[model samples]
Target: MKSSNVFYLVYTLSLLLGLLCVIFVITWSKGYRGGFAWDGSAKMFNWHPVCMVTGLVVIYGNAILVYRLPFTWSSSKLILKLVHATLNLGALSLAVIGLLAAFGFHNKMHIPNLYSMHSWVGFIAVILFGLQWLLGFLCFLLPCTPLWLRAAYRDVHVFFGLCILAMTVASCLSGINEKLIFVLNAPNSTASYKKLPPEAYLANILGVLLLCFSLTIAWMLLKREWQRPNLHASALSDATEPLLTED
Candidate 1:
């Protein structure tokens, strides 16, 4: 099959899987966990999972893929940069709200925060994501930066972006697992994850779909034929590496 065909096929699958991940998280949060709220209750904590998956996983991937879209490749570089930065800003906003919910719930319930590996990883990932977005904006979008210096930093920016994405995925997986163990296997809880209850299955499936969605995006980036051809140095600063791995 042709490269375009393959790209479209995987692209469609990535969209479907991303939507499914969002749906599954919402369902699991509303169905198994208490519904969402903002009053510093358990329901408030529910927003954490929903926001994290939708923002960090789904929107984050879309932001990175915007530059790779063949149709968009013809658009002005300034336009592309604005669009990319806007999407990332949306993602970061939701991520901030999610963090607030988690911390608020913990404080309200007198529960320890940042005690688990998931929390540690997720906290660091969010910090790095914010930093990456700021640096990318300063170097790429800011007009004053020297072109040569921007070019030099472009590869480094892309490398860290990919690393942050990977960290986000890992954080999500660990978070879901941590949530399951805490909710299902707790002393007073009736359900046991060891028995593979329906909620457990749904959350686990969500994790799997999230992983698949991320991998599909990575595959699209790694396919050299899909990259825009002969773009100007300014427009394709990260083009130095094929895998790109995009901000």
Candidate 2:
């Protein structure tokens, strides 16, 4: 198949996988972990997974693909950059709220924070993600940046973006795994994960879908022909062009 055709195919598959992961995670949170709420209950902690999956996993994954999508090719590069920033901002905002929900629940319950592998990995991933966004905004969006430097930074930016996304995915998987183990192995737990309970199936499926989604995205990113036309060489050349002009 042509690269374009393969790209569209993989893009469609990636979206499906991402959507599936989000749905399954939400289902696992609400159905198995108890319904979500804002009160100082386990329900509050529930928002952690919902928001994290919706924001960091799904939205963050989608944000990385904005530049690679074909329809965005005609839009002005500035507009694209703003859209990218906007999406990352949306993701970041949800992630912050998600963290607050988790931490608030923990503090209220007198639970220790940052004790688990999931917490450590998640904290580091979020910090790196924030830094990545700040650097990208300064280097790519700010017109005051030297063209030569922006050109040099662009490749570095893409590389780090991919790395951060991988970290985010790993963080999410570890979190889901940790949640399952805690819930299923609790003293008053509803089901035995060792017995292949329904909740276990749901959580395990969610993790698998997350991996599929990440792999689909990674495949598209690795395909040089699938990258946006002007993204590599020409985008920086026309950096200061007037509004609505393609870079």
* Per-residue lDDT of candidate 2, residues 1-247 (tens digit): 8778878899999899988887887888788878888876899999898888888878888898887888878777778878889999898888899899999999989999999888988888788888889988887776677667766777788898888788878888898888878888889987766877899888888888888888888888787898878553555564444333455
Q: Least accurate stretch of 10 residues (summed lDDT) in model 1?
A: 238-247
**Model 1: per-residue Cα lDDT over 38-151, one tens digit each:** 999999999999999999889999999987887887676667878899999999999999999999999999999999889999999999999989988887777666667677
RMSD of each: 4.2, 2.0
Q: For candidate 1, give the lDDT.
A: 0.87
TM-score of each: 0.93, 0.93
